[model samples]
Target: MVLLKARVPRAVALLGCFVLISSLLTLTTMAQTTVTSGGIGVHILFQTNKWVTPNIHYKAGTGSWTTSPGVAMSASNNSEYPANDGWFQFDSSTATSLEFVFNDGVGVVWDNNNNANYKVSATGTYSVVSKVSDFKTGDLVRPSDGTGYHILFQPITWAKPYIHFNAGSGWTTVPGNAMSPSTYAGKFSAANGWYEYAISSISTVEITFNDGNGVWDSNLNANYVRTSPGTYAFVNQNTATPTTAPSIQGYVNGPGYSVTSASETAGVLTINLAVNTASISTSYGTDLSALVVTVTKTETDSVRVKIVDKNNKRWEVPKSVFTTGTLGTDSSSTSDAVDALYSFNYTQNPFTFQVVRKSDGYTLFDSSGISLVMKDQYLQVSTTLGSDLSVYGIGESTRDNFKMASGDKQTLWARDQGSATPIVNTYGSHPFYLGINSAGQAHGVLLLNSNGMDVTMDSGHLVYQAIGGVLDFNIVVGPTPAKVVSQYTKLIGRPKLMPYWSYGFHQCRWGYGSVDALRTVVSKYKSNNLPLDVIWSDIDYMKSYHDFTLDPTNFPQAKMAIFMDEIHASGQKFVPIIDPGIPDDNNDYAYTKGLSMDIFIKDTSGKPYLGQVWPGPTVFPDFFHPNAKTYWAEQIQLMYKNYSFDGLWIDMNELANFCPGTTCYDNPPFAINNVNSHDAIYNKGISTRRIG
Candidate 1:
């Protein structure tokens, strides 16, 4: 797959010379802050050796603190302070005093003045001293033996510090090894007064700190987790009690549901569930008191299970979106459960369900252990996994492994992010995963919901935590991996076969400056005895990167037609990239036509949602709009009339935008593990709350 940010051309067996073009416009912006008169303006200076951005966690008087690790501070250009210092200016017109702390922005290390925050009453510059001595002026302190994973600890008070650790598998003997007094002048070492220990030849280590007499700091018994080979600070020092990490506020497990009534008809089971209100509310949203579950035997190998609020109406994926296979009938008259290729069993109170293979009695999915959480904005469910599990295909992420690791968290929220970034949501969301057991028996599960979610695989379980939508799951059972895939595709419609020539060597790049450059690239490939089947053009062919418009100077209509004739004669094809953002210009035919048809996504104020893209100000076509198909077809045909391209490269369909507007769905109460868990839902994408 070609990512928009960085397109890496695939190496094909047939050698080809592709044209490269330079983009004419580059977007760059500098942030400027303006301070109001009478507002408190305080500049903070901090020093550190680590190459990390400095940040400040600050609040005015008794106000709430800024989001951790707080707002980033800019590198100081002030001549009065040291050149290496980071600067942060606090300007709040209504504020009296400021209480703040400096950090490295990663939440790992901080300069908190020994846990007491810094305070200031007036506008001035204050220097934060985190280290005992400046490393720049003093002799640089290095580890006794540099090659290892190091941990620097500052105990509450200990005569001798020892470390009990494990690198990959086994643990060290008894009280473990003694630690040395640190002379390191790094960010972690400088801020945290040092008692250091090194574990040689290991990339990661799980450790617990202890004194020689057996008083231990095992991170409150949870132990410090594995981290990469680098000098780190042991921030937690609870020698008496086990360490407990902070939990998300107002987030808790549900009391689950109980089946108040159940019935079956024509191989379909419908159950009415009553909410168990015995547990505390999750507080993200009010829990529905009642829910309904429908289980359908869609086919011999497929089962569909859907859960939703019984009384109130809610949004669901439209039935017209995809073609689900026909629901099969069970002629057995004995029980609600039909004996098919798979069996569905359930418990009544604190509901749990299981899908098991009938032949081997192998459980494919079992939710017996975990509680089900369903709310207006949050939903969570989990299934137990077998010991010999090898799961694949919850994408579209760029992962290094085909089989997912045990401790992996995959977020499903489509965004216009590059595939080069691993373990983050990108371009498309596929809530399907295939799992195989030791006996090679495979099964597939598809959570047919479009809500943002984080799917975690850890400790013999697969958990789903969604911020919206129902728990609609489709399971396909197969005794073999290949058969499981076939069964899965049958249920969710098979992919369309591409044109035969598409499999051949295709040359493409962003910077084909003109028609002449494209022709030169094709000629060079032929001269070098390399096979070339298709030529592609990026946004360079468009007029100022506006959709459906050609650059009259570089790719004139007359010249393009002549070039098309030459390429057609050689059985070669041409494809041009088409971005979804329509230029909001009044003179643009496509934009005007779409506007008349009312096919553009609108902002909260009922005006067309204008976003920034290559075309400057743009509006996205609402594909969900009734007349969108007609308007889009007309625009594509108009472009085809100008350039006889063979295929269309739909780029940036993630509906990417350079600037997320004020009315966009920037924040939600429940957060998904979105790209690095730090980015907002509207980051580089349209608002999720918008609809046709």
Candidate 2:
């Protein structure tokens, strides 16, 4: 019953020393930290303390590998780690987080090939690298083992489409396992043993294996890079028989550079032999001389592209370096760029080409570490668009000249500002703040990492895509909203259905003291039944709102059990609001118990935050902080262990800053306001809705 083994270093294990350390390309402008913003903001500094463990990555589309607790499992294709190879991904392009995390990341998961699932706890810019990990205990394996692989990317479908393994004959694949349109799980496509599944592309090929022992082996070929958006299938050329795992070695080159530009127009110029990809989202030196550099912005995948120059230099090209499209045409991605590019007069720089993992930004370069460049020499392209450009891409935003346009310029910005605050039509945080397309279809984006955070859509681009990040969200795409929601729930652990009354309307304010004052509202709704429901309770129903206890002075009979029974007996439901903030009286049972269990959120001083809430200065449990959430959820069972809660009402969720809307980013669990927050998602000229 051994499960997984060891960790796989992103470079060494997964890629297997494809290039010598010295050959590792040097960056002319290497980012100290990688940050991306949309509905949410993500920042990762690989050179920092996080370097202790190499980046984790795998080649599957959106898959997983797990075992019993304590079993060691990792992702990689190299032989370095005992067990390597387990990483899954699904973006809004297929099945990712478009509504959460600024709608800017993808979802990832592992399978028992069953129901076990987990989600991204943190939602931001993070990195993962796949490597050949060592054997520890569980099922995690290495690519070299020849077990087979699956990589799926289906933007139009979302039922568990995958490229899987078939044991009987040759390295037969199993498609539709990871991307099915049906609700069933663990189903296989027999007609074509689709080993390497892809609704869009296949980037890397890696695998896991069991040798009838406690050990497992893994290996991968970094050469698998996709050139288009479609499914692909790769058979293990070495399956039926065992053979020595192949070793691939390549070279790493440039980091920065100097170029010669031929300036011809206001914001466009052609640079020769200079390479830049990272700059597509930023600004750098001009290869072209003075021309009227009013604004400078470039576009592409909205991330820096690592280009391997003919001289073999590896430099990061800023996203703002190249001019992109407008309400018109985009020749850059089009094969006929030489045609429609007339608006800006752009041309491919003979010297540099942008390179990235076609599957996703998971890896910098393909196995060959080479991709051609198509710099939008502004003078040659569109007139309405120039270097000081306005463009957008997945998990993208601006900072340090790496913005939508020059001087923080935005090509589009609009919000629902009214002459009068529309008098709360519905005043409650709608967990259903998701955006849908023209078809009234909402999609699901399941975030993969446990390191949680919020994500948002750009100010105007309510429906954007997240190319890559640590926040792997399950991408549930669909033509229908309900279908989207159904698939999404499975990705993040579904929610329990509530009683019918929970769906009806109820009036609740903070000041309905004395059950009679509350009973009056209930009686009115009951007599009318005008599509009305349950009685509302705020604070007076509690014994100082301590939770799990009733106020003796208020209504002793209205304890947890009685309240629930009363509501249920009426064919109704009772929903009590609970804030993340926990009371701090050392004498209070809940507080003292939480403190003793060491499950409360700590301050910079490393103690619980005694903040003022309805509870009157309490310790707000850190739901984003893993341990706190586990203990917090368990505490629910602790209270409900005796009496169950019908439906949970999470309040003060945005940390409940009384101020509302936006707040400060100060101490622990502080609020942050930026384009990455969903507060920025606004429809420019489109309508959105939920499908699932």
Candidate 3:
């Protein structure tokens, strides 16, 4: 029996566990139990292509696992591999109160995790479904065909597949001369409907799989590595299960939020509302004593709506990044003072509204189809859109084109998925979208909340589901797309001005080994008369990839400074990547200063959060912290005094960490739970990247 313990105040400590355990025991006795005396059914699932038509067997807790008359797993849907689920049911009459596990017929790889065994009660018809996990990415542990390396790519009908690898020799594509499918005759083949490649060799290697048109899969910090020369197969597979917006197909508005009072003054409309349903709990940080809706006519063509708690304490984007000041009213107390370009009509019961263009009476926005919900941790708002809408500008997604297709669901979660991987949330997050109507006029909507969310563009409707923050939006309407962008930029800050040379050609690469190699690159560019105005460097120039330190042996400070002088003499510049990772070395000046100044983001327990990046184990500066700028500037000055770098290329500000953030906190914010916000360590070899 497990003893339930509780930590409580001294006065209640003695009675806490007793009261809770007694209540639980009483509840268990009242629960119903089924009885099945004849037989129980057992079901199991495994990757079809992983095991070559191997028979499957099971073992009860009372006896050794048996395979005498094992059943064969069918190869149906083998194309799905890891997600390919096949099941078999068997009659079990002998074992009651049975605990069992599945095994491959050969007795090698068994599905067994502590306490994960399935149990059977000798009650009525009973069945269990279990999935056998696939082998790790470069592992030889399994019932296998003895191939050294197993490589497979999610099959795409459009392009031919190939690999670019560093196998002792410098990086090179497999069928080096030409990529004609027939040229790589012996190398390419298909396994269970997936494009696969297998090789048996030993070396300190790195690889990435690519299709013909520069599409590739390479996790920035990790790649497939095999040391011992032996046969292995890449058992892992990629599935293009794009995330869809959370379904609200049959949902109905909970209750009609009534408008208790309203007033219009100086082109601003303010409404005081009372939630008609007490069951609707929208308050997060405080009690929902009241609700307020504020609408302002910001421009002749655009209006803004903001909903929030009556206390006026809702969270919003910091003023540092959002610099657009509010527009003051010209007159007082009259609807006629508002913009004449658009008109708004709203219903008081359940609170719905429609905005129409005054010239042609075209409906710019309608919210009657779906209900608006704003909660402490959740917010939902939907608007009807025109059928021929052309949408763009949800920043930082790798797409062949800028326009978002109809029915495309984009998630606003910043991630570290390196550039070139399409259909996944990459670096930055901008919860703003521009839509052009059939009449060639465009309008932009900006959801000002910074929380993660899924914004779906359903056929003629746009839905937003955010995890937290107030439901605030600034709308812009323009007759042209360019004008719409200009208005949107006014709400958010305008882009930073760039230097003249920055507009010229800039060349960058990851592995420019040493000072000599960099010089050679410049020499080649000059000899060929290529217009290279600036030469950039990746992490290789840093000592052990630690930021703010040059590799003494490869890029000696004296020699590097001399090289930079030579480049400057020719009217050129040198730039280096400055990652936001500070090594946790006690003697390291940058880290020590950050720690002393309390500048690093803290874990749940309030200690500085540690993550693994280029510098093995490092801490990240909390740019949100008040002292961050000072600390960052001090660190940059140290490097500037020594290297005299012309410019710094800021990267990895997405707070990319090899160590998963979910595991960093002892108690994480519940808002991050449902959102696809964290990643797992690459050593685990599970595709833990969250595409949603």
Which candidate, 2 or 3, has the higher TM-score? Answer: 3
Q: Give a tens-digit lDDT track for model 1, residues 91-170.
A: 34555667887665666566676566777776554555443223321121232245777667765444356789888778
**Model 2: lDDT to the true structure:** 0.31
TM-score versus the correct structure, for each prediction: 0.65, 0.34, 0.61
What lDDT score goes with residue 450 in model 2? 18
What's the lDDT for candidate 3?
Answer: 0.58
TM-score of 2: 0.34
Which ten contiguous residues of candidate 3 have the minimum total lDDT? Answer: 20-29
* TM-score ranking from best candidate downward: 1, 3, 2
Instruction: Please list the C-alpha lDDT of all candidates, in the order they appear.
Output: 0.70, 0.31, 0.58
The runs of at least 3 residues in candidate 2 whose Cα sits more than 4 Å from the true structure, single-residue gaps closed, are 1-496, 529-531, 557-567, 624-630, 633-645, 657-692
Give the clashing pairs for model 1. Answer: 20-511, 21-511, 219-243, 220-242, 220-243
